[model samples]
Target: MEWKPLPVGIDDFEKIVTGDYFYVDKTLFIKELLDMKGEVNLFTRPRRFGKTLNMSMLRYFFEENPENVSRIFQGLNIMDAGEKYLDHMGKYPVIMISLKSMKQPSYELAFEMLKKALKGEFQRHWQLVSDSGRLTDADQKRYLRLRDLEGTEADYADALKFLSECLCRCTGRKTVILIDEYDVPLENAYFSGFYDRMTDTIRSLFESALKTNESLEFAVVTGCLRISRESIFTGLNNLKIMSVTSQACGEYFGFTPEEVRRMLDFYGLTEDYETVRQWYEGYQFGNAEVYNPWSVINYVDSCRLNKNSLPKPYWSNASSNNIVRTLVEKADFSVKQEIEDLIEGKTIIKPIHEDITHEDMDSTQDNLWNFLFFTGYLKKIQEHQEEETIYMEMAIPNREVRYIYKNTVLRWFEKKVEQKELSPLYESILCGDTEKMGKILSENLMETISFYDYQESYYRGFLAGMLKNIGNYIVLSNRESGNGRPDILLKYPSVRGKAVILEIKVSKTYQGLEAKCQEALRQIEEQKYEEALRQEGYSQILKYGVAFYRKECMVKK
Candidate 1:
């Protein structure tokens, strides 16, 4: 197999280029971006989709860092776009700052990070000044007079403007401004109760610096969530948002399936392509089918080291629970039923938000589905263009994300049932004591588990989910209903060949209970439940019939 470079867990452009790292040619984005001619571009992607690295690549290509540009973008696709831009690159006094490091517990630490980034910007400008030994008369005048621009709230923007002007004076080009994770402070503040203050501080600083600066040629801002432009860039309306849903540059952020397959072929891991797709290939932006790049690269690295076996869930690590919490809390009766269906590998119908650049879900149940879709948790299975409706569905693409969502859902369900009396029913079912199980079932389990009146499948599903929650039993539901029907079956594999089959029937009258129970038993017998158990290598089987009256349930053995 030919050698393949896996840039696993690497997002720095300089290291990726100079260290002989595997590079994906997202440099096509530079051409696309330059085509837009937007002075202010804002991109919102979920965390860790190579936003930082893309910005770094842009900085390397356009920031006028003459020495670094030559080394950083060598053998890259941007080179094909022509070197005219490279001559202007790094010629300006670029101010690149990342607010990601400001995830401090306190606002003071965040302020410190802000100050540190500003200082770095200042030092970069000073370094350029020191390198230009013989300054022009205009440069000399600005240089000597610039000492009076001391640090203050009013001076910060002017100071950077002055430096960019100085660079244009000396290098003859306007400076490019790059701000990464610009929403970090607000995100941190949202969780920490400092949202208003942080918003105020950042707004003041950003509005001053980015709003009316003549020395700035263009500015780019990247963040996970979309903070309102009105809140931060309360400027004179020159802003252009290039969020993931935007057609202008969506292809550059995530790895399209074609790219993943091509890279797989390059590494001779094409045999594991389906497995890779199962884990990371559900993300779609318009017509583009993309995979999470971080997951793909990490999987490739693991596969390479292990001599080519596909890896599990490389992108789930970066997901945040804040949004999931919002989704769960805002879920309605329909949402709960839909979620259970999704967990059980069934599809549900709903509308999804095409543009989900925001972090939180709307407080409505229907909106939760839209939120899930936008954040990439749920995806569209089919579209009904005639009706203007999308048939939304969901699955755990990778094990990592599966684990996270499972744990989160488990925790949520656990918390809900924590103070409720679950011991009686749980113990009754575990002990295989039918009478007590029936009493507990009638008393509690039937009422507690979520169910839909119209969706009998969901009621059966709730029973299954409940059985699994009870103990280490191989609980299987909706197995084989001969005439295209659904049967609820449970196999207690951990109980040393102890297996149980439950058949449920709903009745409106007490007299009909016995008849429904008899029908359930007859169906089990007709469907050859015993034969299925024998085929499973279990000779003996315990059978039970559960009858339901509205929310009330009864079990008989």
Candidate 2:
């Protein structure tokens, strides 16, 4: 079989089709949009799920380019919908802009990026000014200011509206607007401590272009989250949102199961279907079981070159994934328990608020869960409605996301151990305050990620890592002391004053935790784990038997 170049990271529809890249047929998305005839459509899907590519496809199809439309989409799926659908193609003036590049460290820089992107769009449609004679002197000046990125804040806010009016006047037709990654600047601003400023700017921009603009025929906006309408959209009553939970346009974003099978078969990777399914499949978008398009393409590309290569977590490496880490670090006891349950192949029911803003993210546990669910960290297994509320039973979508959670937990714990003030824990242990020690240990355990299969080795490693800051003591882990190997030993050899020994046990159930703690203590006594420390001239010894059940731990001294 001849190898076709994969369209990895190439978001331009014209380039993908003309370059002969392996393009998945999502052209039917256009037909559906026309059939639904929404005044303004908002699609929220996880990043790298072909949102950009689909937006570009829409641009090429409807951007009033008759010559390129036939060449680009001649053999694609939407061409089969007959002339009624094809007649609408390339009929409207289109404005395409992507906010993906607006990810800057500060509001000022991000706003500048936004201006640059808008400037590019103006330049793309420069023919509206040069060829058409409809613009007055004032409109022409405003167009030049926007095209040159020399516009004021007000000008930039209303730039899209102005551009749409110009296009309508120039072409004698209303305009269709396509905005990709529309919430990126808002997300960046939230993380950079300038959310209000960015929100005001974006709200004004969208309010003019989408809400109040008369020249807009229709608009399609795509982003990772459906930001609250009140915050950014204000009173856009014509807005229709299609989130991950929405059945509309579900099959357009991610690759469906059948699509993945056909692609694998085309690549002579039919035998690796199960492996691919386990790693990249299982995301439920409405009724469609979808796979990550980015991961699947990369997996197939690598497998075609080298058959022995293993499937890595390709999607995890695409972005920083700091949102999930932040959510985990800020999780309360119940939230942490839910995360543990999800990691352990269990399901959790969460009330989902689809209209969440960046400001509402850390305000409540449910908002965080909703953010996770929309961002593809979690997937819906089932959903139900009560009164006016919708609740979803969510879990880790696939092995790749599960691996991300596991690694994120371990990395986050390691960082905490480095930055955490261990003096309180150390002092509690040294003063023989079992209550304080148990509280501190249990708090740390709650913060760390835990799974159902709480092995003794995992606990031993965790205990040893947490006790690394014991002052003036050498911490040894899993070393032979007397009759057997203890979990961890803190030896104050030079001072010869006091030492500490820990025996770790993992209980299957919370009810058995106390018995397991006592069993661990009995093992410490029977094995004489402190014999080596006693022989080193330590006059005092502190022993703790710690039993763990998931994230909860019990310590007996």
Tens digits of lDDT, candidate 2, 461-535: 788889887888889898433448788878775745678878888888989888988998999998887787676
Among all windows of 10 consecutive residues in model 2, the one with the lowest summed lDDT is 479-488
Q: Name the regions of candidate 2 deviating beyond 4 angstroms.
A: 423-443, 470-557
| Clashing residue pair totals per candidate (backbone < 3 A) | 5, 0
**For every model shown, what is its TM-score relative to the native structure?**
0.73, 0.86
Q: Which pairs of residues have clashing backbones in candidate 2?
A: none
Q: In order, what lDDT does every prediction score?
A: 0.67, 0.87
- In model 1, which residue pairs have backbone atoms overlapping below 3 Å? 63-90, 64-89, 64-90, 64-91, 65-90
lDDT of 1: 0.67
Best prediction by TM-score: 2
